[model samples]
Target: MNTRSQTPIPNVDDTTGEYATFARVQVDRWRDGQRETVEDVVAEEVPIALEYNGISHAVMMATPADLEDFALGFSLTEGIVATPGELYECEIVPGCEGVQVQMRIATERFVALKEKRRNLTGRTGCGLCGAETLEQAVRHPKAVAQGGAQFTVQQLHAALEQMQARQQLQQATGATHAAAWMDAQGGIVLVREDVGRHNALDKLIGALAEAETDFSQGAAIITSRASYEMVQKAATVGIGFIAAISAPTALAIRLAEETDVTLVGFVRRQGHVVYARPHRLR
Candidate 1:
């Protein structure tokens, strides 16, 4: 698969892996039948290549920041590694055209990954983009480990409110999505943001792994709508319940039902819709 991590571009933050998230640009402003020049900060989008065992896997278009966390989260949520330790090493090498995240995995896992690669694999953002068959497209996640946690609508609202405070990049760019881990008591534990909602969730999931968190113990919230792929990614790691500030795709709701996850959407202060597994909600 040719995941083009866009051709490398010259950057100011060459020394630090932290590439700039946005750049100032001059644009013509037209409002009230008036025209003026204004400086605007636009979110930076770059190609981020993920290479496993020295071989390329995916090239994702993403905002360049919190990459180490991105690498870990992508690996775990993608089922490339069952545990954080299965991934041995990850290195970031900026190329002439894009950035490459080189990852080394346990030998056995590496072998399994290769064995699973087939003629029909690797797709774009959709969960089944690269799927070769219906069975693969609808692959089920492992049963969630048991956990007893319940919360009120107020708690879910509070947790989402907390997410708003931690979104440094999104607040600045207005072009990013955030996926956050929130405790049952409405505490925002971790947040990861990306231009891609999947990437944001993946990064947050990775950060949780780095902290050795029990996925079943908390809920997930996304600033964007929840899709089947989002639910699949969360379920792959046993995230039992997920809330979205927007709506849920029909497929996402169906998958949530099959995966035994609580799918909540339109998470406003006054109300929220529970699509599946409402037993987990109070």
Candidate 2:
């Protein structure tokens, strides 16, 4: 099978042949002296190559868990396939170098995906690709239905806090991002984390779809900056509102306005800035 490779979690100490190490530190104790310590750990990245009808499309570095979600979400967001059913098969093949995700889409979708392909390349952090122009790079998704979503400022504030508290991988590595679903009652119902911000949001969408959650009745809370693609993804999945812990880019704001997505940025413990579609939030 065609495969893609990514960096695996490296071993910290050769003594145990494991991904851990020991450290010694000098401490000025009143009654005791310095001490030595040991810790066990591993680092893993999600390396996935998207193949459509057996042709390689793109490879991304992400957290190697929930790969089925990653494949489906990426396919949907990138316009590779119109619906999840277009993707017929997916599998993860582990290798000595990294994990290779193989996906097979319908023949019709594969042809369309091939025609839309560009010479674009991806780095560890890049999300948008295959765009021939700046405008294409920021293609706006259709507006989401407002659909009776109403939440007080207090509820939004509480939801942001709840999303932050649920980011377990971010707390552990300080290197991951999270996307969460919050009900009008300020309760977070679902959360997904990943090394890549886009992947985190994709995982959340996949999880919501898998659970048959009612996304139109709630909002999405993200623990990262709001980007144009992020806004597009939320809107694509029929989310009416999105709250982020950081600022939204100008393009992101424009897209949110066109897409009828309520965009809130600079969200803190007490307040937030509404950039677009404020009507959704009461």
Candidate 3:
């Protein structure tokens, strides 16, 4: 029942936006050549400011839901904290422009975070937009210690089908992306949706870390394209494989190769493309 953390499950009251997933707006709908006024549902994108130890780190545009997960995931994948234990507690504070996810972390991590970046913020689609240089932008993750996670082509297809059932946010607004964790046989376990693909993956990684799932037993499935940063995030979190509904970029493929991650893309009901470590997915 505690959604804030995996370690102690902080006793703080939940300040996350329970009803802020989507909003309704009036729009014109065309039916049989006739346009009529109707209500349209859109995904809610809010500014999520991440502050570590009261110091502003990054203000990202994300769905105002499961922000605690977002904070934990972002911290791990972004290299702010080496482990989830470093994060003590997360305080969600809603403001005029957006929600500020205040994370109480170890002083060492906070000091390192401050030394890494003085100020950083990014929108949904901007990967490493705030990084100062190419080296900082493409910080590669250490290769996965355990790779060669095997799955069948049929399992990949089934995983894609299961991912659809968990995409509630995308079904509602048709504008959000989802990241799901599925067992090796292709059973959906945990899913997180967000306006940003990276954030969605971060949330999923946070959940995976909480559950401490065996990396060899499952793979990550994403609703968006597999970018270089996506592979980096997966490798950073020690995910052995990734299946995406779209294609993988050149940089993503290269990163997957270097990180020893099995990357699969264009995952539909019938087929998929293996961009990296094809031997892992039959």
Candidate 4:
């Protein structure tokens, strides 16, 4: 509905194109008589405003990549709409302030959305926002249906290692988080990264939806702590297991137990602790 010009932000350089012109430099610390330069890379944060059916919903500041997935994932995880098809259309309107993601949803869903609107006053460190109450913060989804999602110890270890290797942004900026989905055989099939941990998971979910990947037969691996919200998001996708590199909160553990999603925490180089639903892991 709105139109504006958009410019690309430079992040990767491989000796091709304009980004290649900037040469790497080395810097040294000098007290008083020398000058030096440090090798540096630049990243930009763009504001993304989500509007549902001509009504303003929420805005987020994130790296301007995989926007379509971001929009769809946000809508589904935030409960704006049940499925991606509920979003009739989505367009990116660029402005000096930020990129506005204008989304059109079903009329009935829009009416439901307006009632849940809250004044999100500040930028969120994570992609989660606009919750007016504490109960909303801990919104729970039905537990995943246990089918035949069983993983061996060897497969679990391999999935964790694969997830680590797929963190390209973390390797570059050292400031991003990643969430990955691994299939039953333990191969990391899809990985998403973002400045926000929740956003990374959302993007992963969105990508899965777009690619039509089957989540019922795999697990979700994250590079951060397993919080209650994280557990909820994983459960929303019907993931049978969630393995994290950090500890799980009490709420997260409780939700995992209730949802029947296997929760594994403290996943490190060689060991991990299964907090809940250990039956999924062999």
What's each prediction's clash count? Answer: 4, 2, 0, 0
> How accurate locally, in lDDT, is each candidate?
0.82, 0.75, 0.83, 0.77
| True-vs-predicted CA distance for residue 270, candidate 1, Å | 1.3
Candidate 1 global lDDT: 0.82
The Cα error of candidate 4 at residue 207, in Å, is 0.7
Estimate TM-scores for all models: 0.90, 0.82, 0.91, 0.85
**Model 3 lDDT per residue over 1-282, tens place:** 766634211222247525368777999999999999999998888888899888888988888777878898999999998888999999998766678888999998888877776477789877787887677888889988765457888877877787898789899899999999888667888899999999999988887776776766789999989998889999987888998999999999999989889998998878778888876776
Q: On residues 40-91, what C-alpha lDDT tens digit does candidate 4 reach at each position?
A: 5434456678787777777776766677888888788777788878888989
Give per-residue CA lDDT, model 1, range 34-112, as digits (tens). 9999998777777888888987777777777778888998888777799999989999887777678899999988887
Candidate 2 residue runs with Cα over 4 Å from true position: 1-43
Q: Model 4 reaches what TM-score against the true structure?
A: 0.85
C-alpha positional error of residue 164 in candidate 2 after TM-score superposition, expressed in Å = 2.3
Candidate 4 stretches greater than 4 Å from native = 1-36, 121-124
How good is model 1 by TM-score?
0.90
lDDT of 3 at 224: 88
lDDT of 3: 0.83
